[model samples]
Target: MLMDKLREGAQGRGAKIVFWLIILSFSLAGVGSYLNRPADTSPAKVNDQPITAQEFDQAYQSERGRMQQQFGESFAELADNPEYVRQMRQAVLDRLINQLAVDQQAREAKIRIGDQQIKDTIRAMPEFQKDGQFNNELYLNLLSQARLDPNSFSESIRNQLLQQTWASSLTGTDFVLPSEVTLIDKLLQQTRDAQLYTVPVAHFQKTVSVTDAELETYYKANSNQFRSQEQVNVNFVELDAAALAANIKVEDRELRDYYEQHIDQYRTAERRQVAHILISDKDAAVAEKQAETVLTQLKGGADFAALAKEFSSDKLSARNGGELDWFERGVMDPEFEKAAFALSKPGELSAVVKSQFGLHIIKLVGVQPEHERPFDEVKADVLAKLKADKARDLFIDQQQKLSELAFENPDSLDVVSESMGLKLQQSGLMTTSTAKAPFDDAKLKQQAFAENLRDTNANSEVITVGEGKAYVLHILEHKPAMVRPLADVKADVEAAVKLQKAQVEAEKQAATLLSKLNNGEDVSALVKELDVKVESKTGISRTGATLVGTLLNELFRMPHPAADKPVRKLVAMPEGDQVILVLNKVTDTDQPSAAKSMLQTQLAQGRMIASQAALLQQARDAATIEYNPLFNSQPVSE
Candidate 1:
């Protein structure tokens, strides 16, 4: 969906650059240096242009945070998977290298982005605007929330603009051939009808007999698949801010001081409860005349709610007397907000006002003036805030000492746990697939299984489990990988062997049925012999939602059937069922000329994207890249 916005804006250079800025706004680069690693220790280099370790880590952390937010509790399962971590690292590193290559190419080509252009582009962003104009306070607040300083964010924007400019220049103008447009149009208008019958694998299971010798042979060949992963039992000490805050006591004076310092947090913005009778006609004169008539009726003491219900064009609000609900500044149309906020009295009504939405007769129903919360009213909240702040300060100090003590006294976590008032807890045996909290983190799991910890029982350095949480772990027990004996896995192996045999039998039966159908036999006869019903779906497009999975894909792949013969095939379903599909008819509907034009436009945009992708690949292929050995090394606890 974001790609669609980028493609749509790519028509103009300035618009394309602005879209790039919006993209970068969500990246760590746009949010400035959250990672404070030294720039000299580069993790990767693209054509001698180094990508600092800090940049890579910041990007990785940002991506991880995004995934954690998306998946919630399940994110821990993915985080602990070695394959997933490897792929994530490669993806981040590749992105950083690509960016560096693009920047280098842009510089070589003499591409430049002006300061004024950057300023104007940022000001134009809707996120930083209020009341249809740039709001400096809003802009600063947004940057602050993103952890970005103004100067660094602006520089990032400028660099991204330069890269986008180079990309645009390389793509040039994308033109779609008439033949390509015709092909796309034909595909969009194609439809098919098919008859389907399924042969379930369960039916063949009872007929399948797996001998003991066969099961033994299968288990021997696939013994590696049954081997268990290495495991470790860990003893760890954990500290969390929330748990610490629960025991903290806040004095009355502390609460009062916090309340005084953060008074703005308790202040409410001014809001107005306004209602309007809207006459939404495209013709300006007609809408204004209707609004004037409504005003006259209101002045004559006619009920506003009754008139609104009868005449207002805004259907949802008309049912409730045209009530728009409470709103603050910068939320409504410029003309409408001005008229609504200017009415000082509760019963005050504004004259007929013309807005982009047509004409409106506005009434101010009520107002809520800005005010700060009283100390007594917010005392509990203030106390909680003070406690949390104190806990965070205490955690930071304790965490630093804990890290030092854990490293210095590498034999155990006893000293650090006691000094920080933390409890040292033991864990059950954990394998690579362990999804438990704290252990679910890949970095912690890697540390728990490290050779030093497993062989020597050495304590790990302080590891960050999450925000405001850290742990130091030492291995208590180690289990090497081993395969289970045949006797231990005989039942599971027998089931697997029987399932495999059933699949083979089903495929043979499917092939025989297909062969018979290909000859001149009616498909219904075969269905009747199998005692299964055939399902008929008509007028289904390639993208139809009614048919899903492999069956739908098989139907579209079938060629148009002849008058006397239908195309037939066997499709394998995920549930181990085989679908026998007979495509009876294929029809192509004629599209309107407007649809053809739209197709051509889409094809051209797709071509432009492809061209840009090719250029980026070319740049990357030409650039020399080197990665630090530490880049792929095991992660160390922080």
Candidate 2:
């Protein structure tokens, strides 16, 4: 149970603080190398500690899996790009080197995490708890499922704790100076009001016209924008478990056997339809007294729902007369669940039950008996499960065979497709960014366009397209990237050139308007002359989201208006428009005590993070690191 708790806690923590600190530290320190060993055996070394090729490959694969999980099919396409792959490899190596450096430093500092500390950490994790206390059985079961033994998992936790201690000691106190806190508070509380006059590029379009020579020159210079991406057509074969399930046959005996073996899955636990008048408070004495009073009112023949509605602190259920609907054991707090379940008769009220939420007066309103679903009623579901289980087993066998066959006959996919009784599928011409169904995978595209395979016209090795799906393909046709003729994209080029000319005219007009405003001419009067409307917004802050584009940003950047003088500036927008912003007033309000406290906490946390990063960089500079040339020359998988 303790082991299970450790596994559940580890997975929930997800590599922990040390892992992230290492990654962030190395990123800022730059790559370091010590001495190069044989390329085939180790890819990197830190202070003579070799990072084995197997370790590197495993970390690389784990990172790839995480990316695939996060980005889905899109990551496969990203993985195909050489630059993205190179970045991923470098990131993996950086993390390894940084971790080694930190581990060495911790050893030298004699910062050891004791076994008791590891036990305490594991015990504190909420994942392995039942009824607000750690459960030994749950902890062990979780570890068994995660395939981790207690001793090794505990050791890993200990090391992480040691690293965390060393890091925290280096970071020191997260104290912020009084002056810095005051400045941050002032920034957060400051507000500005502005008058905005927008000059749309469309307004200047009529005054701007593109010449034929200008259009032609623009098209020639930006021809790459109109170029078509290189595309390919491929012949491929795909295998998935769902498709294979249709060919699987499950007999009656097999279905019956599966149903009997998994009978517990179909059993329903006893449930109680309960309602409670809860008096929640941090003070147990106050909550218990309130609960006693509510219970006394119920005993005096007062309507439960009416009294509950008036006194219950549980606002959500109070509206419906404190109806919590039906729930089984483990769904509610153990103390509450026990008290509610113990009442056998409907309308029976229990003594005030004390739980984490304070005190509760539980009433049993309805009951549901535990029962197992009849075999005949669930036969269809049982049969489906049996077939699905059989299909999964079959898919494993067939997928392995397919891989072996495809590798043996890499010249073409025809033989493997024929032997596997699968049809050879064809894809329409697709570019590198194609995310269409069936042909949407980037990894598949990368494999199809591999130089070795494309040059030889040979088949690709089997690639996992998605969960439980694999495919192999051979390129049938390839088209090199090319620029479209001037005639083909002349209309697009003309439109783009016209838009650019309009933006230039708009900027020139805005500059002239700013000059007039700077010379003491009122912005509203100038905007009226230009036939543009002036919009006024009050109480805009540094991070206000109402004003679009650079309007809000420009307002904050302008100096505060003195006495009667308003600050003015011309700002460009992303949509080719210009805004003449007039900072009318700046208000500095005093921050509330609660907000000031929160800000102080945030500033302290930021300072600590920065300090930790600096310490990591210092450690890396003191360590000797080296990388093998093989890291650059070899594929990540190799």
Candidate 3:
């Protein structure tokens, strides 16, 4: 009834957002729970605070992951290149230094973030939300998976906020001029007319040729490209509770016994539908006297609902005839709940009662009595509980045994395999690329091929593949990294050589056409000779999709045509396609209101970024910094 009354008055966004607010309140209730490490060496330091090696590694890994997500396959192609990886590491270190610098300065300024502010920020993150509500469990699980605790996560967030707040505070002088906005809007709305001809790399493949000598030369020069990933065959014993549960058998007697033992689990609690008229005053005696008067009036058959609306102090529920909705035990004040449940029939009125909030005359609206479900009704649940209980106990015992045995007898899993009655599963030789389930994780794959284990035939420590599943494995055989022989990869080699030659030829021909056009000569003859037709496009924006990004950007970068003259250039694309572009005209039109708003937003963002960067650089300029040697320059963490 309380819900019904609230709904009647609830309007628009206010009604919709109430649930979100409730969820927001409890979003971080468990973040501090389940919330450790070696003394790590420093890779760098700022203001005498060590930037530990582990911290650097984690930072680099997080940056690499962001790039991978944003750039996808393009990032992957250069992910293993030494120069690219070094630049990535340097960038990550620079970011860390900047963040640390800001953090130090913020503390000096006495800038602070409240715990509630941090929690509220975390609660509002879309990534932590599911179906429009913050999922506390999901948030905790992500932190766990990221190897972060609440303290570390909160500190990280605090630093970010400090940087943003500090930057915004300093950017008060970073206003953009209307002239600049108009200029930017015009540039953004600029359109180009151009003639385009695509030189497909595949078109020249037939004209290119390669021989065995060339293939051999290329193979030797780039052997690393052809080398096989180091691989291993493993034998493992795994424990999976779900898998184990499938084989567990529970008798009818056991199911019945479990049901009886935990019968409360199947019983629903008694609930009361209650309504009350509260009479509150500064004086307790006066409040009681007023409540007794209301009770007397109710006894005289005055309409309870009408009296409630006129007299109750709980205005929210009073508007609904003092309805408190249906609530189970433990949900209300102990004394109030006791008095409310004592009444046997609907419309039964209780004597004036005094409680924590005020004095009240209560009415028993209805009741939902506590009841246990019949055995047949909950039979499936009882069986499942019994099976799960058995499986869990069995899993815990066997997991302990597996860990102990795997450690004690590191040479083999056969001991644990037999001891735990788990079958030893074997797999075919597999590289990280071809790893099977349970070994697909790069860390697990690394352990499978660890030199210590490979040399001594030792079982790995118990590793969890996921919930309810874990395994200990030992390498049975290993194949060290080796280059593929030319004979074995002849087809791939030929294809690569042909593609390389074709791309070179395509660009060369496109360059010739570009040269002719630049000299103000007709390229129609060359285009005809190449059996290609030029396409004329009008009003192409910066984001034109007909041409590759490289070419389109190049076309827009060309100067505006003067006295009917055209701008010509040759652009090469990453995918090996070449574009011969002739820019005929450049025009700027009045931007729509939406375009103006977008340009304003973009200009503001750019200004903010510039300010933040300048501020950070100033910080870095004044900060004391140091870098230490790294014994090994590791690849960018995937």
Candidate 4:
């Protein structure tokens, strides 16, 4: 319900507000409106705080950027939808509301998260820490790169922790009830031990007699379903890459002049194949200088591989004696690539180059000289470009005729198909779950199987299915709903019945095993009698997709593993059958360092989602939201 509201809000009046506000802000700045205007006029108010037009527009822009990253092409379509913008604004408002609430609560509850605590938390973050250890420089550099000041970032973290403390209090109140556990056990405890029985549907055949009068009656009653929709006949221009290439004409003189002017583009840059070593920044500048001294010795007749094997700090590369694969210009860092490419001959040693990776001494083992192309040699390339240009023009010509003919003449796809030389294909009675045809483009398949298309009746509609090609679809026929004859699906139904029986048998056996265990009978002996293997699991962690196996998602939600609860976890494997785990114990791990490090990522994502929800609720409660009367009056962008 909330998601639906958010979706509606995103597409309604909210989009108009965002668009107009942005335009006005830009226009105001251009004309110096702010200089002559009073500062007190705000767009709206939230919790007694003025929501300035400037602030609202800034928030809208931020939301747009996030939407672009998340939805890409979808965001472009959504941008024109006011309800979508409304929802986005609500999300921003939700965040602000949550932050304010958390700040107030933190103050009231005397929750003081100190700088040292923030430092400890930051150090514990795996992203900032290097090699499983805290490095202050790594922390500073990474935060700065993310455009985040460390103090502000830490303060944000503090606010999150305070909010999480509140959220945990609200949503995570734990309780145990035997009745509830029993019902859960019954629902979840599934097992299979029964033999399957098959009933072949193919063995049964039914003969049906339809009178001519009955056939006529049926056809007349459901004539709309049988009748094909009016198809399209169109002739249009089409533009494509091949047509563009065909139309491009390049003269001999023009090619020669263009080649001369852009000679540098044709000439390949000189390249060097080099191998080098890197040393750790243990003593920062001193270690780098010392490593350079060692590098010089190797360049002056020392074995390059041996020196690398001894001095390189990069373990993976060091094992191969710093033998980095050959790199070209732009592949390596600018300073390193420049130094390497500047070498005139092989086996030449270059001066030390400093990079963020560290200082590197280079040695050239191979050289490739730069070469330029003559204009005459590339004439064929020019001619091919000309043909492609022509093809594009022809395509565009065809497309325009196609759209016009299709739009003008309905119920005549054959005319357009014949003229365009495209074969008409028929689709089977397709549902939304139909598999993509072999010849169908991925985009076409996506459109054909969209939920909207599935519900739509017979109508000739144009859908852009290809990257540049459009399809004028004609829904030809539809099948009416009827209960399938039992003989047709008897085998499938029988197989379903057998699987259900097997599950019943397995559950029955599990109930007996539980009773035996409660009576203090040997659990292992009982399992042996039942001829089932006893599966064991170990070292399950609270964090990560590791150790818990594929069925871990099911287990994590289980209140407790044992306590006679039914936990169906994947049988300790990447891919395996489900094991009905009688949770033996729920153990908490003592990886405080790991937990503290991972806390930021998990808490931040979860809090952001909750904060957005809260913000939307606050905005919805305050505003008299309405859609434009003209909206939904016409078909919108498909």
Candidate 5:
């Protein structure tokens, strides 16, 4: 019931924001909890906790960092859209506010997060530790540098623990009944019998024609789509991990020692290919007796494959003579696994064994014993990993120096380049379209185009692209963003206009066909009259491989058919293809096997997640949340 509400509410933007807010609370686990300093403006406040603007900016930057990686070149395009920025910032703020709510709820419930918990968490953090042990002086020094006192920092750690505990209490407490599991399983695995009437976008595209004026009008109206990409050229210095790895030299003695120490890592586990004839029945006694009878037949020199194919209840493996391909331990039921592994030789059979699935007569078919590859064969991999490890250690030391040098001498990358022996390099004028690595990296690009770097003409702080790789750059040249002239994109504009018209015509034809089909028109007659092609099928699963993605979704979304009438839906695919669906019947699973167990687990988890999300919403409602003038709750028009 809770899951149904969540799925239904998921269509709303508010519910999605709330769902993601729950996720973000856990993701930003150790962020600064609360700041008490009096400020001109507060971004938001949850109950008694005042959220500082700096915290909001930090969260926003983290969000941007994630988006920068995922969207790549397109992320920069998002900046031009003000609404995206507003929503992103609001989301971050909401997450922070939700976190405070979680903390409050945990305290109200008498959850005690002691100082020892905070101390343990802080000690475990790599930033505050050296050589895997907590260094009090280092921790204090780093906190002092950040201008965060030890006391306040420890408080933040306490909050993180409370939030963690609170999140833990929310899950692992919900469950599903057997009936609920069966119903959900049936719904999920249900198949449909349907017929498809497709009107190809290509057919309409060939029939449609657009005027030059229409093309020009579209180009002018959607100028943003044809805007020139923003870009920057920079003079930079980089400490690359691959370069460092190449320069390092290792002794043969060290290589031999390392190989010997970690030799077990290269060893492969033993695997067995076995066949079993399963005797699955609700009555355990019946199943065990049947399995014993099969075992007796095998002992009497009956062919194993023939008996398995005839008697095995597991239909999937039975067809292949009950052959289950090579498997290692930990994948099968404990009793079944132990029984299967106990067979010492090929063609050896196990006595009837009881498992979760019922009773099984097991046979050992083939074996591949555990073995390690020769050192010569694995030398290349060993060397690569060793190089990576050495480079990572070197990078940590060098990265700190790089950041210090760039900041202390901000005028140019020359200082860091000369000090670290890295060559000072210059990038060609690269637009968002033409940007290539290492400059093409999100952090590097963001730094290259940052207002402060451009305004000050100073070297950027060390920007890390990946593990053991960092760069410091200063912008040398900039290109202001502009839309391309209509003449330059004339061909693209013409294609767009034609496709738009063609899509409209295709949708019209598809909708008309759908109306006719639902109103009792025969599909065979409409195929000739509407110039569309029809394909029919039965028992199409949700994961139907032959069905187009959009049409498949629409097929299941439609209500079940009544009597002779079928459920009808028209789908307009993004790429201009149109499909009219006629869903004739819904066939649900009659007797579920392991699927019921799987759904029970999944439904239990879903119920917990839904409960957690609902609680977060309730917390937000109960708390006093105030946003400054910078934030507006009203929707932003695109």
Candidate 6:
């Protein structure tokens, strides 16, 4: 179903399927019947094509560019981190392999996409539309905008659909057992009654006074807890991009002249209030002459917009008085723009204009003269330039002093610190798990903990922080990986002990409640008698998420209900408390509806796990998947 729906966006009046088939044929033909070529290049082959380094680089760069908008300067992180790079490369390779497999299958099936279908699919894409309907000129412009060849773009969409279909075929199934259905219904049950109870832990809290001696003892035992990591107190020069932008200047006279010379760039191109009466199946020559006749009528004093409203087949613009809004040159077909722009005067009508869309009569309305930018309009831009220029000057001066202090007296970081009046700021202990500093750009953070930067003392590393600003960091200290001290964890130990006790107590309570329920005692009555809480949930679907604090999953996994024994289940809660749930009743419901809902959720989770497992196996199966020996493969860098 997902594969079928993937075509929905591209189905241009039911023609995309045929179109995609044609595209796939061409792509397959390029492989020249070598779909199963040996995996020789780097031990993995895709669609009979050798997995060349260049191909890898191309995919890598494409992914890199897509990520650039999010990563900015930190795009280097992928390249610097060997594991990250390898993972990304493997993903690309996996996708390529899957694509090849799908293409091979499509080729075998002999699916052929027609020319008309391809055209229709292209027309349906919003990116290639002029206004709402397809225009060939607009389509070409869109391809140019994305720097993609028309055929290549179409082929990409085709391959994506092919892969979707293959993936669905491999994983989608409708062979669910009735037992599975019954099990799901029982799992979905949420029979929540009422929960009422007091936590006795709060009562004990008031009497648990920690003495000064106890606090002292705790502090002494945990003194290693307060013992901070070796943090680098860095002496550095700071530069702000905004400060640079503030001092840069752009002259007003220059702005005014630049605007005047390029006034056409700002000019509002003329638009036509045109309409057409299309004879859809008419001969091209006959339609051309007939359209001329309609143009002649408008020239002979017929109202252009009025005639458009009455007879134009272009319903969208026809209903709006046929007023085509101002569009720039190259936006419309050349023939249409030529005829429309040729009618220079208001109320003047042009001869019938021929385009890919057919023929159209054009009328000129009021002309909107172009306006040039005045010096005053761009004065702020000039001021911004002035600010940036000044900031650059100031930054360069400060950088020179910093460089001299650091390089000349390389023995100590103090020379730069004392002379520049720079405050030595220490960082909190940072690890791969720590959240990145907000002020530190992604590139800076990457470089700070980079393997190349590690163990290098007092070495200055510069990282770009966008807007031409950069950060220069000096590593003063480095700590290798080491075990955490047990003495430094007294508070943690106490908390763990408390939670362990609570869990034991909760388990005892749960077992007691279960025993009473097993002996024919009402669960609600037993809960009330023991002063324990009773929670019930109702009408929960089998596919629905587990409710908080419930043993729903364990309850669902239990053996089916029978006369001999009742289904009992237990689960540990987040707070270390335990829960016991028993399926009180079971019932059957509509299978199709339930199956659809259940499979949707089940299939999603199943697919993710399957995809991951499949990809891992595929990678492992590929021969000699070796890493560069220079890369440290250890989990933790020392």
**Best candidate, TM-score-wise?**
2
Per-residue CA lDDT of model 1 for 252-282, tens digit only, reads 8888989999998888778888788888887
Candidate 2 yields a Cα-based lDDT of 0.80
Error of 5 at 261 (Å): 27
lDDT of 4 by residue, 589-635 (tens): 22234234344445555666676566435534654433223222322
lDDT of each: 0.81, 0.80, 0.81, 0.54, 0.80, 0.57
**lDDT (Cα) of model 1:** 0.81
Candidates 1 and 3 compared by lDDT, better number: 1
Show where candidate 5 strays beyond 4 Å: 1-105, 111-174, 227-429, 442-488, 515-531, 543-546, 624-638
TM-score of each: 0.60, 0.64, 0.59, 0.38, 0.51, 0.59
- For model 6, residues 85-193, the per-residue Cα lDDT tens digits are 6686667766666555556655555665544345556667787676686565667775664455677667766765555555455556534465665555543442321
On a 0 to 1 TM-score scale, where does candidate 2 land against the true structure?
A: 0.64
lDDT of 3 by residue, 55-116 (tens): 78777777766786677534644664777887778888888988998888877878777654
Position 76, candidate 6: lDDT:
59
Encode model 5's per-residue lDDT on 486-587: one tens digit a residue.
889888888888889988988887887778777776657656755688889998888668686777777889998898878777777788888878889998
Q: Which consecutive 10 residues in model 6 have the weakest lDDT in total? A: 629-638
Model 2 bad stretches (over 4 Å):
1-58, 119-154, 170-172, 231-238, 252-389, 396-430, 447-464, 470-480, 522-531, 591-594, 626-638
**Candidate 5 or 4, higher lDDT:** 5
Error of 1 at 373 (Å): 11
lDDT of 2 by residue, 370-445 (tens): 9999889899999888888888888889888988998889888899989998889988788877736566666776
Candidate RMSDs in Å, in order, are: 17.8, 16.7, 20.3, 18.0, 21.0, 17.5
Off by over 4 Å in 3: 1-166, 245-393, 403-421, 452-454, 457-461, 474-477, 519-525, 591-593, 623-638
Candidate achieving higher TM-score, 1 or 6: 1
